[model samples]
Target: MDVDGRNSTIGYGASASGMTDFSRTDAERANPGHDTRQSFQGDGMRGRVLAIALTLATLIGALPVAGSLWVAWGSANRARTDMLDGAVHEMLARYNRMSTEIDQVFDDLSSLPLAEACEPVGLMRLRTAAYFSRGVREVAVIENGRILCTGAGKSDMPASLPLPDMSEGDVRIWYDRVPPDVRAPASDVARSTVIARNGFALFLDTEQIYDLVLTDPRTVLSMVSLTSRQVMGVRSRPERAMLSDMVDRFRTDPPPRSLRVGNRLIVAAPTADGAAMALAAQPIDVVLEAWRQQAVPLGLLGLTSGAIIFWLILTLARRGDTMGARIRRGLARGEFRVVYQPIVRLSDGACLGGEALVRWQQRDGTMISPDRFIPVAEAEGLIERLTDQIIEHVFADIGKFLAERPTVWIAINLSAPDVESDRVRGRLDRLRKTHGVAADQIVLEATERTLIDARRAQSSMRSFRDAGYRLTIDDFGTGYSSLAYLATLPVDGLKLDKTFVDSIGSGTPADDVMGHILSLAATLGLDVAAEGIEHGAQADYLIARGVTYGQGWLFARAMEAETFGAYVDGRMAVAGPPSRRRRA
Candidate 1:
């Protein structure tokens, strides 16, 4: 059989028994065959193997993403929570700390008694107050709108930025916009009290306000005055005015407490004085980027899985024999024979091995594909028998070649039913012993479904692993449940489904998913064999990305066992001297 599903003349049984040797030596031709065997039919898919494969892929992509994300998110949330709480706590602490520090100054200014209209003693009292309240930049006496003597001498207050008319308030805040620095954009504030149209003012640092609000380096904060429509510690005057309007609107209707201001999360917390608001702003994209990184392959899982199952279901729906009794009879008549697809090592294109695929050439001339019959065998309790026939015929065809070139291997597929029932192990042990083939000379293939069911058939799947046979997950990344299977299953390698190999370098949506699958397989320390590679570019991509082996039309298609043997023998002859020298 060739890749086009065409028949070919190979080694023996071209008509009598449908068996074509995978590998044959001339000496075996002279001897009568040990057993003249058989015919069989099979189709596939149950136990949700593909579904489990996908579940595992998603979980792999999700874990680092989810873990990094959850940790980053949870850490960010915790940091935000702590900073907001700290900002509030420090805001109140400053209010109290300043209150205690300035209380004596406020009392002294209020009680110093009105020094008679610009009296020199007024200057003396101003000096005394300034000395007591170091927070005060200057002390001033204002009598009937005339600036009296102050702590620094005759006063000339900037008339343009004059203090607003004061009224009754315990502690008043007003900006002294005198001698502004254009480069710095900073302003000073004066705290004052009035006595009978005359007042004494004390100046304080405005940066103290800036420090009180902006608590964390990653965030910005602003305090807006509801009564005056003024904002302190904000960057621009217009921004202050805009924030004032927002704060005013918010106070009237304060539901939906947080607002977005250009990628930043703006949250408002009212101050202790009830006269102002404290707004904290942080970017939301920090968490969004984290989620996006992990979600790169999320869409591929659904699209690929649907395509796989839909094709399988459509294939399974076709008319074919699925019963055990029929398969038993078919096995006896030799209706089934083995075809081999050469597994090529990506590094050097060497023939690593071949996977044995069963093809049923029914007597009526209707060829039943494996997809049409394997599932029915499993559901009908005939998978074990089908496997037995496949194993026996595959080794029979390849037996003599393997005996000569002991290093060469052949892989055969087994299912969950084969593993769960222990029938596969018994047959393999007996056959390998009879053929005198080392355990390493044969590879046992199973889907993730087998490993997941392996717990039940532990003795079977484990026996394959323990006895040195390479066990692989067939059609990997096609389903959603193999995550747990990877950790617990005693498998040795992963066979990437054709879908991933097909999408290689197409710039298709599945590209990222394929990269992720390859990365995950590597991370698990499993060697990967890519299936369905049909293009040079695809082969190049998989090889560059660390694929160990590949099987597809890109190399040679599935062929009769005899053709595969010839191919392998030829390759070996070409590389034989150097290989032998290296071994020597």
Candidate 2:
């Protein structure tokens, strides 16, 4: 031992100076030009050997990776083009089918006698015809831009029709504004066209084609006039201007081979009716997703490509460190506060306990959950200090209120170290005595991870019970909880994990697991309290199955101690008591 009472390893001082031998040797070699022909020749051979090895490696490794990437790059483009082409074709095909169906309906309607279309009985026939036709909202008869009559429950047709100047026997599509006098029909489908017969024209519904054809919100299908180049119908609201731009630009100059804007691309194909080009603007993200599956093979090109996993680990470490810093700062600044989530008897909603949940409330009125920061605290060795901070505030804030409601338990969670630590019993005992509250009113929630040393855990839990504090195995069934642990641990109740509770009655395998857990708890004669009972059905399911207590948003969220008092008051006013249901 040194004079300062520090122990020193043998030869520790020698290592500090002896590490400089190579520097002194190099200094000696450089002095006065000491000849080094043999050394130089050896180094030259080594340099050549290293260079040759690196060159061969570069040739072998770079070629395959580069070639693979190049192939993937081309495949990605081809796949992207194919994906967009498929979307465009799908749009065109849908509109074409709608047109074909409408044209068939038009063929049937045009052959009707013009006199019959203008009669009241003929109007009933017209209304019935409009009902049978697909995508037809209302039918009207027109004679040389003059409104004649419509189907039943007549909507005023436009006095002057703006028909696209189509040559005789030629059909065209164009946009026409709906008149304000039109009334909405029962059926939602719409198709409008002026079919000339003799001197009169038949007007059919038009606007509902966008719904019949387009399901995608991003892609737009526009019907453009062949000669006048007017926009007839647009499927999507956002892509309406893009379609107009394409039409205006395509008319002024030769059409651009590719029409793309930022991450959105425009794909156009000739419509089935040959009257318009079906142009659609789709996000490039769709193309990227289609091609992502093909580039996965490039991962096999590098034998040591496992570094991404290491990089991920490092990234997570950095994030943990950032979160750790925030927790440490929070401890200093007192940014965390304890909120109480109500635990109630399942049969009726009565406040039996309040679970202490820590929340980080920033000054800007945003809350960060304990789940995000608790694991970070545990990993960073700051859990004990964090818990201490919360408990101290709780005692200062609500020790008197808890003493008044002696039957209502205030549950606080503990870490693995807390269960085995020497100071826990002393601190808890002191707190209980100081608050003048019985230990039964203090429920310590713990998870299976706290049973690091089973014997020590059992001892600590027994000590807690002897002091009159209730014990709960929190987040039960999530970790190392098993029959052995349950049989051995000295806990009063099992708090069902939220994951299982969320899945209750969902018909998942979790429902079966819940039954198993309940059955096991019953056999062991343990009280069962289920957390995260968000739905009424979940609470009813547990209550019918004899769960002792329930805690979740279905009843109330965690609140301040004063708020909890108000909540309890409200509950007592409605429900009878925490022990049992009141017979009405």
Candidate 3:
């Protein structure tokens, strides 16, 4: 009656002084195990579905970040490979030029170098060869431990030479050999490389092997001997152990081109002649930098996608929960039942009629309260179907009983949508004709809230009244209940809301309002039915105030069709004699 049928004119009685005893005894006496049969078992299934949706959303959101991380790692590796390839390209270019220059120097000195030895002609040829070659710093003649001649002038000093660092067939190469200028500081002087064959040697700076200019200062470039695994020339100082490890790893039969050592990445490329290897070393942070650049957008995209998916699932789940889908299923399964609460005359306690209330007991025996599903039915536009079902249940349960007892009437609560349509009237007409029940015996009750659009409700109430049906404004004093508002509607009676009735002796301001409501109903010449009357004092007060009809636990709680019929029959017998009266 109150939006969700919680305060429907015809539902089970609320707890008062005597309702506890009445509810238990009436339920057990009328239909055993009926009260214990209803539950909210579907809640567990709904909870699990929600939990699963949340977990899936979380996983879905994290997937993109995971994929991004993988992509970032790949990007970092590619960057390292590019750096290695660039370093290798530069080293190969310089090696090619140095090799070409050395060949030219050898050719220039080949004509007269060995025979002339320390002579003027040999010295002149050496100076000319040194001048023609860009890589060669000096062209000299050496034999055993003695320097015979030099490109600049005759060399009288002893040739201090050690075993060659690497030997390729007839050629011997000295890496980082001491320079001839002893006056220069060791740090200031560039280390030299000496390549000797026969009685001749070409003096070249070790830097010429790998003269690198890298964009990343953290990068280190070194030239390593492929055969001996020796680091020959380095552009930057790196740890000796790391260099050794790199050499050991790259010294395989076909050597690895790249590898990671500790926090550094090492890349190697063999020179064209295969005599030297270009090694590029850099910290792992370079790879991380690449990863960072790519991770931010991917992570955001993943998070965004995850959030959207979660919202969609949650929306769908909530819709499934509240869209009255389950209510429809419950209806199809015949989970709904109809019960009646007696409405008696306050003066004699005579059971004149009763109000029909709908109860939904699921297949599992769990009862879904009308308060939980009635508003959902209205919101989903399924109130008409629910009303039709209740009407059918009412007639099916007590049609013949009502026919035999013509004076007793049953009030059925209606929703706002029901008042707005002619469907209820049509259904009522068909049922009344089919069952031979008088239209006046079935009263239609609408709460004051249903008449928000006064003109429409006035017309609908008038139509029902014209069809010989009793119409009452139920749950009065709870909504629009001003004298002006009530006077405009066509209704046979006014049903006082439980709030005002409960305030009868509470000494609250609402108690005063109840008097005003009774006065208004009397002034409008409408019969009054007090709902939720439990105590004797309340009934005495209503009777004294001229409230003709009253219903609550003081009389009887809502009961099944058979029990209600039995109660009516017993009351009729006790009342005796025939006293013709109009339905209240």
Best by lDDT: 3
lDDT of 2 by residue, 445-538 (tens): 7765465245557787788777767777776665422333465677777877677777876889878778877887877777898877778888
Poorest 10 consecutive residues by lDDT, candidate 1:
575-584
Each model's backbone clash number: 26, 5, 7
Top candidate, metric TM-score? 3
- The pairs that clash in candidate 2 are 175-232, 191-205, 191-206, 192-205, 192-206
Off by over 4 Å in 3: 1-323, 573-584
lDDT tens digits, residue span 312-342, model 1 = 5434433332355456656777888877888
Q: Per-candidate TM vs. native?
A: 0.44, 0.44, 0.49
lDDT (Cα atoms) of all candidates against the true structure? 0.57, 0.59, 0.72
In model 3, pairs of residues that clash are 1-5, 37-365, 38-365, 38-366, 38-367, 39-366, 39-367
Q: What's the distance in Å from true for residue 559, model 2?
A: 1.0
* Tens-digit lDDT track of model 3 for 40-136: 3346667787888799778767776788678667877887778777787667666765775676567556677486756887788887667545577
lDDT (C-alpha) at residue 421 in model 3: 78
Better of 2 and 3 by TM-score: 3
Candidate with better TM-score, 1 vs 3: 3
